[model samples]
Target: MAGSVRLIPSGFEFVDDVWGGIYRGGSYMLIGARKSGRTLMGLQFALEAAKQKEVCLYFTNMRPKDLMIQAASLNFDIQSYMNHNLIIVVRVAPPNDAYAVPNPDNYLIDYLRDIITVVEQYNPSRIIFDELTPYIGFRNIELLKDTFLNTLETIEERDVTSFFVVGEPATEKAQQIINAISQYVTGVFQLRKSQSKINNRFHGGNIIITPNVGHTEGQFNFKYRIEPFKGVTTAPDVDDVPSKYADIKNSLAAQQKTAPHYVYTQSKQDKNEREVFNNVYNYNDFLLILNNQIALYKSTGQTFNLVSVKLNAMAQTQGLISLNQLQNSVQLSTERKDKICIKDNVLMLLIVRSNPNSVVHFLSRLKSNLPSDDIDYVETVWENISILNIEVNQDIENAEELTEESLNKAHQDPGSYLPVNKFI
Candidate 1:
């Protein structure tokens, strides 16, 4: 077992309420359907754990290592630590490659040995198995079960706090896996794909905690949304960690400001006479508009890109330099019929008939036109600029697919922009 260590706060209200803080050697399960924010939540836990100066080992078969690092930068600057080797990411093959393809006969034992070897090598204080489903195959069920159970035993022996992610929460396989390993784990948190009765178009879900060893048992309904630069935020008003602005300015940088004064609507003749500007819509209206636009894309097959621009300087400086940059960006984009709106300090641009490539091009070009990227201004005001293609669909879980390609690009990398504190 690893040596005893000081306890650390998770920085999440729900987590703090549930367990106070993570147990030094506890094991947890995060079960959710695909795209249910499982990875997001797991990353949040891992990032907090790493920030405590504890060695953290993340085991994942889903997202690549680069993507995970890029996601972490949203909450706080972690590149220095990653460079120093405090956080370690372990990438392993999925079940098909690990079992069926490579070692036909010794699948379970081989993979089991590999996982055990990883833990033994790193001996990290925290271990996260992101989406364990890929490792637990249906073939040779009994042996695979034994392999998994043995791995759990090894984790317990190591006295390492662990997190396991399971996709397809509603499936019998998830249930079977849970029943088999639930006793060994300290707790289970499930994220589901559920719609709210209050708003039909908005996609969010409930998180249920089934008690086991170290945490209280309870359920909480939470909303989930992704910010272009911020990754996944459980709340609409705030993110899991501080926004980029917080890195340079005081805490006030994250406080919500008075809504910008703008006209609601106007007639065609009035629009021609006056400044024709679309009203900055609220989150609900943004969803409604996005839903309608998605439907339009389905019918027309026209490309539509959603670009979220955060005025990181909005709260820090009254000079409105960042706001002007946003306006100029919007003005340049509107030439192509791209409509813009503000929601939660982010200027959301609905680029009609433009592909992801063009959106990226425009934003990058517009960035050059902004005030010289001063180190202080860049840190406090100019944060990451990312554009994700919108695949207007009812399935929220699959929404990430829209940004899959962009996530791999060099410009989308976090190192290209300023890092910020976690928006707790």
Candidate 2:
């Protein structure tokens, strides 16, 4: 905790033993697949350090303004820190088309040299590279690797902590470059998704930290939720206005309409009021209502008979239903006496035979009912379902064990298993 580089005190928590030595002047690498929250976590670190009045410099080769806005929304106290010159963000734009850094010999070296100049001018305690993989292509991995190691050495000599972020989905050559850089860094952090033991289900993701000589590994996972402007804490949950209300407020302001008056005021009262009413009659709400109706039908074994019915209802709610006369727009039928049927505005499914395995399979398929774009969300929901299955299986095992024990007792006492039916 007394090291030159220390994690700032925040509600953020780490799991297991993943906090490798983050001492000041050390070089650290953060690697993850795209959208795995790598940049967000790095920005959070920089913001936390700035809160402590430590000079922190952030360099971005991607997403500069978006990162700053996200940091600001987290109630990072950016203004206060900026007033104290504790935080500085340096944006790096790829060279323009006319003057682009051509298929490179050492273009990135020039960029790093400029970055070093900025570091020297600021003399900050902490420095971060948002991502360097893009700037350095696959063919130039070794050169980038060497330059990165050399930069680390220089930062260490100056007692400045250096943090670098790398993303995946790059060429194999880029991965090789990262692998080489990984060797020289004092610490490496990798974030990845893994299957859960509960049921071979996948969870969000966890971070793994590897430390250099004389340091231990660190691991952590983030469980996030939106918090009011105050900050994240564990005292008690606060009743913040939902996102729908916020959107309505923005719409009202854009239209220059008066916001609805509320009985009580909260933070951003005008904004929340505008959003609340706008969402009530929105098209999105109508779609949700129709979707809910469809869900009810599917859940009650009416899917086969009502498939067309549900689709028509959905199309009607979405204003996509046509009034044109058509004889074959919908159809219905039964196959193998299974009570399957479908027609316009009607759908049904019959389960004449039921067993544990078949029921489980049916439920699993039903659970997969989500839009294609929401695959990740579906996966998460399935993971939860798998965990429930594990719990049920465990309970069944416990019941069988109890029944065995009862039978054994009956055999020993010659009367323990006597049936109540006999007495009746």
Candidate 3:
């Protein structure tokens, strides 16, 4: 009511008549079942936004090239806009090739990092994040909440808008989670398939937009269909946020003082901000898991080798660059199930379900995988790094003993990779 509302049209004349399209700089959620035209609707919206001369960042799970082709098929010739960078399509995923990581939280961190990097680099006013099902399985409601909360904060800081897509949840609990999270957004739109009464094939679909912005009342719906060059269609990417790209981005004080009278009360920051990553583990977190495993092993008779990796000139704790370098080495030398803990120049690893004898071979070859030790963060050469191990069992009360013993063994030789320590 105070500031003017910049409405990004949804490309549908019927729906925009009442709601006045989607607000600029606001994040919105679009929920739909499979084949419910979620991707189509997002694509159409992106096309329309580009038409209004807005720079759009379309993050799709599909290849950017293929998404461009699909956009052209929808009667929107976007090639010129693509060349001009009016609509930049990016195939979004975590930085690491291995999607699965030891810590689920780490995975989310890396994914969020990717999003942040893209936003900072391109600085697009609008963003479209395609699907949520692939990343947030809805198996973890906490993960979903974290993803949205962080995304909202990021969008607000940049003053950009976004559209995050969520697949229709089958379970009641998931729907409940969605309902709970919805309070933080400016709007929630549900795209449902309106099937034909005759054959049950998709004849058309409907969109229910429940706008929280302005003096807009309860939700409303409209019918639509996909024909050749018709109903809807990059839709390449993950669940979205930017106040929404099609129709999304967020804030409370910001939204309140601005055009729309809506306020987005953010989810509490009660959860840890530690991101999901494929590459590294926070030392404290890894230590807790190590102790738990030690306790569990005492009864179960399951044992794991404790490899103490010492990088020379390494600080007591790892910073970002060094950690990423170490993470790169871990990716090259260790298995996905293996857990690494770094503290005070020593990197302790629990290579799960691995060969005791092959551990030495891994250590021998790992040196070759280290980044050029000449790099700035790495003060000394790789020659100073020592990889040694000790067999860990119930007798070892905690991780400290395991690492301490292995360090002693490495100190004994100081030059070459040592064999498994026989002194329990």
TM-scores of all predicted structures: 0.49, 0.46, 0.50
Clashes of each: 7, 22, 40
Q: For model 3, what is the C-alpha lDDT against the true structure? A: 0.61
lDDT of 1 by residue, 1-424 (tens): 3556423455344555334455667777888777566777777776666555566787777555454455655655444444334567666666565543655436646766687788887677787877677656545556666777788778777887778887764567657766776666767777776645325544457666666763432444455554444444554233432344233223212221322322424442222322323333444555666666676767787656765554444343766365545554455435435666654344666666776466556655555444444567534444544333343444432323433323333234534322323210
Off by over 4 Å in 1: 1-7, 62-73, 76-78, 97-105, 138-142, 169-171, 195-203, 216-424
What would the per-residue lDDT of candidate 2 be over residues 170-218, giving only the tens digit for each residue?
6766667778778888767776643332133222355555666334433
The list of candidate 2 runs beyond 4 A from truth reads 1-12, 15-21, 62-64, 95-103, 193-203, 217-424
C-alpha lDDT score of every prediction, in listed order = 0.56, 0.47, 0.61
Candidate 3, residue 223: how far the Cα is off, in Å = 2.2
* lDDT over C-alpha atoms for residue 379 of model 2: 48
TM-score of 2: 0.46
The candidate that wins on lDDT is: 3
